[model samples]
Target: MFKWIQGGISAVTGLAEPEYGESHFHSSTKRLTSKKVNPYTRAVVSAGDFDFQNPSNTNVETATFYINDLETGYCGFAQIIHSNIGITTTAQFTFKLYNNNKDLGFKQIWTSTKLENFEIVDKKNFKADNLTLQWNEDGSLRIKSEVNPESIVDLLFKPSITNGVKFGTDPNTYYGPSIEEQWGSMRHVYHPRCQVEGTVTNLTTGDVIEMTNEKTFGLYVMALQNMKPHHCAKEWRFAWFVNETESLVLMQFETPKSYGNSIVSQAIVTIDDDNETKVIACPCENDLKLLGQYKDEETGWSFAKSVDYTFNGYEIKDNNVDNEVITDDSKAITFELKGELSELIERMDVMNEIPQFVKNIVSGVTATKPFIYQYFSKDLTLSRSDVPESAFRGSAWIEVTYITDEREISE
Candidate 1:
């Protein structure tokens, strides 16, 4: 009733036309009935199937560079976003540095944000304010930020040996009657495994935090969402873990109830083991199990003490291509995320943490409570059917959202 009223009002005033239909979402429309091991959502997500999509399109997009220092337990991230809200568009950039050790929290003070002069030059370069992030032909990025006098950054992210990945063949998860008439879309690109060699200096003490290839690892994610945040999904769970010899990452996607409450997920496990050193499996089949969940009395949102992920896919020991489905179990594989969820890094309240303009975009979602929980643990274990259980220091970023209760919509 409320959305119908809004649509009727919008129809007359040239307001935002919220897309209305379910046919546009076929990216995960149906799982193949003949997967070798498990029901698969994405068609063929092979290593090197990852390609950079233009965020400058009619969508809200963000590119993030996250770093983890194995030597000093320090982590940092730099993000540039192309924000397209109702009746407006803007570019935003933010940089944050975190430390597991509480004492050196002094250096964490140098944070920066900007709201203008952003440009996405191509798949390789982007600029927001005075910050510039450019990617080389070899998947290396040069990041330089001088937008803030408080912090100075000169960082370079080079992929030592990593595979770039995305979910499906078509890539964009659309929502509407068709592509030409679609009103919403979402996509993601990942280099879940990488290395960082750079320094972030704080002007207060002239102190420097150095990250190198031998002692630090980094993960890169580029994502896009063209609709109001709440219209996309009801909940999301994410995990990224890298140990001495392996890196496991998972992203669980859940569509909103209005869209039939669909679940489609993607995950990858890259190993440098003896038999295979490549991405063992970039699976489109994922199961996220929420464990030890308790309700937050203050917010009424259920928070989980821990979560688990199970993935099944074909092991691309270098033979799988990007176009067809694998039908043989000869190289089928499975991976599991079973361990402590580590330290609670931060509990992010979306409405309170975001800027005012960004808030206006999400304000339309009146019934949703959006919170993100980030955890970092050094003791969680990664279990694979082929190898011994191994523990690794890694980070998990989770989001628990409550949209409107299930409501039937008439076509």
Candidate 2:
């Protein structure tokens, strides 16, 4: 349950901004003070080794790795979570391997333990019990996990983007604005793109699936939420689209009505080749227009089947200028995902993944529904008014979260 002040609800509803000591929201003239890191250094620190020992016990941090194989149509995801609230602390690791070609749609493995069991060996290495993630000196990642016998994974992540862009307001401070002082702080950093290799062995069936470097691309993300997850955002949508030469990553989330129903978003566009002139890392506002939606009869839940979205706003080029006009009305960028309802890959029911006690606690406090979806389509396309159409034939991951009275449970 959220710890709302006596009049916090009114403040959240646009009456006034919630107060929490000094304000961290920068004015239009004040720019971020953190120094920009080089591409190689970006990969290491972007792993998120920030301070979590907040005396308020509201800090939560997560590191996620997303892998996709274009040729084999296999997608893999691994997440490590560390949260400390008051006197209690929780640490967890989760893995999901999705293979559409296989008879079984996907496999999930998860475990929860104390925070002491997790170790961060510098910015390049992270260990949680039997699972070890090591970023090699050469920039490749060596991952080995023996947490679950049913699904054993050994893989390597080789970054494809040499000059990856770090998306945030300040590189030294939290990823974005300090919304926590008002409502809760939600921040993120993205490693635009990477390539994946190695293998995932199903110990149960004695089967070994080789994950090669052939047409395999990936993305890395680190996120921090400084309050209870339910109190932070009312909804979230994240998408990553990649091809051989270019990659586009977008993240958007909306605050609860109590927080004045505000929306925050960011985007990173990276193009790798000899012909490209400059990389575009912009902060943009996103609008989602739902073209189609599907409601599951059994779960009484609705999800977007197809949607058209656009990201339009100013771009931050340098410290001297905070908001620079990169794309005007005629130069808007838009993306469209067209696919049948039956084609949508239902990744998981996040509520069912957590421990029952925690689930009950959340359910008792607020209304929350979380679902993950993945889509691989040759029809997904991207077009910027300034450039030619770029046909993207790959996979995309989507997470839909609804909180409080905004819950979209159909039944």
The CA lDDT of each predicted structure is: 0.63, 0.55
Q: Give the alpha carbon lDDT tens digit for every residue of 165-230 in model 1.
A: 555444567777777777677777777667788888877677777776576877788787767656
Q: Pairing residues by index, what is the TM-score of model 2?
A: 0.75
Per lDDT, the best of the predicted structures is 1
Strongest candidate by TM-score? 1
50, model 2: CA deviation in Å?
A: 8.1
